[model samples]
Target: MPVVFVARKGLTKLDEKFEADFWAKSLDNVVEVIGNPDCPQAADGLEVGRAYQFQEEQSFSVAKKGDDFAKCMEQLADMVGYHWRMAGADGPGPFRDLFRHPGQFGTIGPVTSAKLAAEFATWDECARAIGKRSFYAWFASMRRMFEYAKTDGGVWLQYE
Candidate 1:
């Protein structure tokens, strides 16, 4: 199965009682918020006010194998002004590890508004990183996600 990065929004009105009840019935299928320690402002967990319900339309499916995926990731890192070599031990570098394990879901972020804004600010850098058609496709996918996050809210990576 391909690992997909998804962004969900527009369902931010669940009260605490509803949230608890929802989780009680669907904990296994519930998605959790993930945090990037490097981003101090990143949400540590799901915030009640900003919570969103998952929707199929929000998915960005990424292939788990082949050169297409690898090259795209390389370009994505570059576009985001993120240098793989400079990534700290706990940074996005772990995303590469997803390829090694197939069919497993790995969650990556409650990527806060600050982080999303920072990434959007680097749009030009990302565009310049697109050296090939394959890279463009990946960049486009990620770009859509980032754009949505700007208004809808934070983002998270669900890899499998």
Candidate 2:
């Protein structure tokens, strides 16, 4: 499926929600972490939450379909691999494997956003990396999305 990426300021509450949603996606009680079982990033008493914030926010834009996906990722496929359906084709990229994670809400924390922005920091640099200029607009938007999120300052990112 195609993905829509959005950025928002970090919120501890939002982190809670993501963790809740992450656990909810798993039909079982067990949840995996990167390494530490007791991931300190998660809040202590967080209730189940939804992507209510992502649906409510109207300030940003959603990039999807051929305009944002196929054509845009055409050149990007070489550096990141063929991702005709999603942002990251495989397990990792300069952007750390886009939306491949379950319950990452089509997006993630500012750290991941930083990883994305780092790849698309500049148009010339991005075009150089992906080898094209026509589809850099989406990358620009993706970069701006992270910049806005950085401006907001958050640990959680809302995705619709």
Candidate 3:
């Protein structure tokens, strides 16, 4: 599955909604941590625009202590719960939509508007980020559908 990048900001209520949605989907092999379980920089929270990577599975965390899943989870929680507090409704173009769908709605590896602004030099980079998300969503949805298509090693076509 392609990496899914989700940004949470400006919507406290929606953060809860995303949590509910993920749990309701009953995804297995995933753990959700609400706060910074491990303090990396001896700071209460990480710098606002930095990106941290971690494993999503328990086994991975156990094998790689340096991976720092806790920090990633904390950042995720902050995005969903607290980032919104600092956001102004009209401060910038995409800040307000952190909780909702920014004009471009897609999911892919951990890229966010803030990240884009910090690293990207031109509009092309931004477009590529959005494209990555769309590609990931399409790839995942199709993979799931294909998995469901084959049952008991037989392709049965049930016609109405």
Candidate 4:
């Protein structure tokens, strides 16, 4: 299985009918509805027969075979504030470990847009210890993640 990332927008009572149609006519085995355990706010109020509307949904694989994953890595490196270069195959890059094991970096969950924005307001001390470039890159990546999360209305991460 490949890691997948999904972007979703929460629906309100007005979209109940559309949510129903989505669940009844569009849901598939490959797409899992993000719920309580992983997204608390999504399941804040429990009710049976209720329809939940997601305004957006996008999936991306994170394995070597996935082009999006590679693109994201390249983009992340370029967007960082640091003037760091990706390490060659023989060397460990600043984000080599993160690229190899994305799940270890963080978990998916509900988060306020402001909170997400605040996360990257400061650079990581550890990354700074590695090098100024590394620190800048780390800061940039965090900002990027926050931006994504804000647009998606939640944190999303999946790994095989």
In the range 1-160, model 1's lDDT, one tens digit per residue, is 4546666554342434434446656532234444333343444335532334543327777555545566665665565456544555445632322222221322333344334445544564646555666556655666666565544444555644
Backbone clashes in candidate 1 total 2
Scored by TM-score, the top model is 1
Model 3 scores a TM of 0.18
Candidate 4 lDDT, 76-103, residue by residue in tens:
4554432223343234434432333333
Residue-level error in angstroms, candidate 3, position 28? 23
For model 2, the run of ten residues with the poorest summed lDDT: 29-38
Clashing pairs for model 3 are 3-108, 3-109, 10-84, 107-133
Which ranges in model 4 have alpha carbons more than 4 Å from their true place?
1-4, 9-22, 27-52, 56-113, 124-129, 132-142
TM-score of each: 0.55, 0.48, 0.18, 0.37
Candidate 2, residue 157: Cα displacement in angstroms equals: 9.7
Q: How does candidate 4 score on lDDT?
A: 0.42
Model 3: per-residue Cα lDDT over 44-110, one tens digit each:
1223222222222111011122233233323322433445335554455332333232212222112
Superposed model 3: Cα runs more than 4 Å off: 13-33, 39-116, 121-160
Model 3 whole-model lDDT (C-alpha atoms): 0.28
- Tens-place lDDT digits, model 2, residues 64-147: 543555455555554555453455434455543343432233334445445556766744474656545545666666667666
